[model samples]
Target: MTTPPLSLRARRAIVMTAAVLCPLVAGAQTIAKPAIGPERPFTAPARVERTLSNGLRVVAVRYPTVPKVSVVVTMQSGLAVDPVEKAGLAQFVADAVQEGTASRDSRVIRREIFAMGASLTAFAGQDTSSFTMRGLADTLPAMMSLVADVVRNPTFPQQEVDLLKANTAQALQAQLASPQFVANRVYRQTLFGPHPYGRVGAAPETVANIDRASIVEYHKTYYRPNNAFVVVTGDVTPDAAFAAAEKAFGTWARGTVPPPPTAALPALTGRKLVFVQRPNSVQSSISVGNFTIRRSDPRWAVMNVANQIYGGAFDSRLVRNIREDKGYTYSPQSTFQAMGQAGLYRAVADVRNDVTGATLKEIYGEIDRFREGGPAEAELVNAKTYARGLFVIQNATQNGLSATLNTIYSFGLPNDYPETFQKNVSSLSAEAVKTAAQMLLGSQDSVIVVVGDYTKVKDQLVGFTNITFVDISGKPITPPQ
Candidate 1:
């Protein structure tokens, strides 16, 4: 078949048509997105607080949006107070508390709670242990009773303790297989030295040594009405909530809670490197950080803002540089943990073994840049907006409100801390963030931890002055014969 070329007139018509359609397609692709509306003023619900005759504090907030209630009973006892020998006693007690009470076994407790379409959970952190429950408002009384029984009368059955120990031992063994876990464990120990905060998780041997008697004693010493508080949020009025609290916990006799344990932390002199050799690891998990200020520091707000701009979000400098620009890893994050004592500032990532050294260099560079100049005005504004948005999202529901209140009491913060946070973060300036960075992010003192094939990556870490090898438990390791 033979085809003839198009005439000049026809070609001109086709070109004009194509040009017109292309602009329409481009316009469709570039359609404007809806603008975000102005943030609504967030006024936290007024919380009513009362102290029972037995010294139990009850804090309640009314959220009558639905016929539901959220309850949390928090004890001031946590890992910080654990005896040196019994490193995991508090955690074991937290797990075994609900396994059986004087009147109900685990099965019966689970069934009863589920029968009411309710949920209950208990957990232990560095500073506090808490038991939480959520259910229909009508079941508030029953829920409170169940919570009190578990908190006051846990039997800590020998069989359950054995099972928990075995399960925890297994979990610990599994975690040791993960490079990220190894890096974090060693990083904490290196940063905090022998302080309680250094002991982030229980050793398998420590778990094995925990017994029923020690668990009972630990509970007796710490879980007292005088040492605990309750937060109730949902459909009930403050008076009704207080009455329920007294009915459930008024008879719980008060006991003395031991003062927080203290230990002198070993000084971190200069940059150090700790490596855990994972045989044939394809990726290296790296953590770099040092201790900073306590939760009560005046610069806490500035640190929060600076952290967001550094590596706290997807668009943060670390993430943007290493992941998006350099293609090192998928997600890299920086976190700040401000506790009663000196807090922790950590930046972490898992990168290919080949790029291990490069990743470390980039992390240090970003941190140095932040400390030197802080964030620009536009960046500061964006970070503050992000922080304020998170505040609103954190208290959007009854459960969320209850959790926030628990955090306030656990941290020894004032009742108006949320309001204070909103005001402070909103007013943060670029200069404030810069000052905070200079004070807190001292790169010279950071302890860098890397878990990878040491044989391949050790020489790559050339800039570090002091490099030590450690096992998964953070104990020093000897070179292979």
Candidate 2:
């Protein structure tokens, strides 16, 4: 059945009618999202402290309100301490601890922990590591004993080592399959460069090659009483807590602190733009950042404020620009991560495939803005308020106390850390924060990396004078196309 063809005027009328109705249809379908409730700050219980003859430091937090208790034995070591060849040694040792023991088998340990409803785990690092035990206050003693056994006498049995090696290899393979993982891994390598922090959590080759001897050696070298700090916080009194810890770990022999090797921070070589071409990525993961002050650096406070205003929270500059305005992604964030010796300030975001080039350009612009002039008074006050609010919440409970201890031990913070922070944070001025921002936010010295389908993004990225293409391994993808 053939109908008479409409004239051009009829077709124009049809198109206009379609356009007029489309907006109406869209408006009808759109619904405003519900407002989320205001955020509440967390508060910690009052703290009590004591020191034992063996130089064991004990801190007890009284929280008669909550039934749960959290205990931690944090030593000054963590992933940051992994040996050069064994990059993930701390993590591997952490995971392998409960595999078995001299007396109790791995299954027995697991069953006991299960029956007592205890959660226990161990983690190691360069500056600090810890074994954490958490459970009902009444069951804390039992959990403590279990953790004590693991820390004092882990038997990373041959069978367990084999199992862990296989498991680690499998985990490594899984992470390698992820674009985000590859992207971040490469960024760390480039940012940290020759620094230990630059290496991935676990070296694929090293993890596959690790055995019981290495784990045992690592444990013995660093896990000593004098070199560690034990903190317990819960319903118990200070005396009781000390006695309990002594009964479980008093016998731990004090050993000299390891003279860890010296670290030389390499000056950032140059400003560079790079990309890892994922065959079929729907979006791009971008990282723009530079090395920052060490954990103990005095500049940390200023950097903290600067980072917050830049992209510290949901309402930060990056999120506001990339998400609230352009709607490129849900949220874009930046963070300053420098552990024991040094950390890097980095901004990371995932943008739609088409927006990669523009997104990075905007990111660079923001960084440049900070270097050129720095944040205004409004941003400075807001960040300080936000940070103070965070400090209160972070120190609010037993978990919070454990966190405090962890941070202290990890970064070798001074005893007056909390007191000092309170004073510093309160007295922080806009001028001080701005100075910190100007010093740390140098865009000309920063690095940029983009991971996505380069074929679609390459033409857009041509504006950058320097662009290096990298494969998933961080090796150069080609001789600059």
Candidate 3:
């Protein structure tokens, strides 16, 4: 017998169902898993490095993959150079540097940048302040000119300075309301003591005290051609790039910027617990860390691989144990931040308040296990593979290549760092990784910072020694008598 014709709605439903099922059926057919091939050796891009008569170092790479160029001008000055009384002066200067130049007002500068369909941004970190511009290759000259003008001649207009300070104050208020922010700020202060890195961010009062004079003086001192370098990448010949840079910045006069004084970093004697009370909070923000080696340390590669196996990725022991097995957190991860002087190794997690202490115990247990036994042979291989894959993937694009080059320059890495990195990571043994972990991740020297309701988690934390009560700002507070 012939079947009756289906109604329009029924036909539509059948069509949709088929659309979904077709992919499923097709996918069910056994597909060959692509074979993991041997990693191709990375070849560094040919670069032309030259110094202008004025002492500005310029590095240019001719990457013809895309019809664009990116220029990064990095100054050796950063937050670490901020004067003691004006703690956020460098950050304030970074903000004001983009406001206006002697030759152009803020509005006109922004208009010209947008006219070229380019982006310009300036930021200051612990070790460096940088201004970057990216645009079509045809506009490279114009973009470079704009960058030079901003970096060299920022007027630090008083009105703009006031506005920046007001905005920063408002933002600070918003950030202070977050438990995570409080935890991080307090953690840095506790870890570094009076070092500049310990400040982590600007205090509102510091921002308020910043003025145009301080910003301009800072610019004159640190933003000299001698103390800065320009990295250019993308569709430009080295000669042409060098010419553009010379025309735009060669006239900048050289000046001495005495390095900032370094404070003796406080030593971590034993495991310490710092509690910041956040009333009625459901989740606790926890940061456990200790000061580690600088970026230039030889053990960095080994430490990186070991960190990945320990807590760096989704499959890391911390995540696998705390999230997948115990459901304590969605993710728990660790990072090794290598700076110019000293760096830090941190393991961070946000978990339900009830599980705060348990999570910390598990984290400590995982570290102890890794220290005792190191990574298994299979785990070591996987970490090496992941590290190598990341290196390849990160430098595959023009922007990524530029960023990598910038990092190399910023950290004073060897000219052959990319090649060296690959060789080192590939040859790293399980024992080497374990040695790095044992040296850097010992619980005895780590500081643990927790931000949550102290009443809910205090009993759980009683096992930890040197427990201290502190406010969100890191000032010690007395417990209720």
Best by TM-score: 3
- Worst-scoring 10-residue span by lDDT in model 2: 37-46
Candidate 2: stretches off by over 4 Å: 1-55, 420-423, 479-481
User: What is the descending TM-score order?
Assistant: 3, 1, 2
User: If scored against the real structure, what TM-score would every candidate get?
Assistant: 0.93, 0.86, 0.95
Tens digit per residue, CA lDDT, model 3, 10-88: 9999999999999999998878888989887677689889999989999999987789999999998788888767887
Clashing pairs in 1: none
- How accurate locally, in lDDT, is each candidate? 0.86, 0.77, 0.87
Candidate 2, lDDT over the whole model: 0.77
The residue-by-residue lDDT of candidate 2 on 255-341, one tens digit each, is 776665557876765577778877788999888888778788877877787889888787788888888988888878998876877
Which digits, one per residue and each the tens of the lDDT, describe model 1 over residues 416-477?
A: 78777778888887888988877666687778888887887766777776888877766788
Q: Is 1 or 3 the stronger prediction by TM-score?
A: 3
A best-first ranking of the candidates according to their lDDT comes to 3, 1, 2
Model 1 accuracy (lDDT, Cα): 0.86
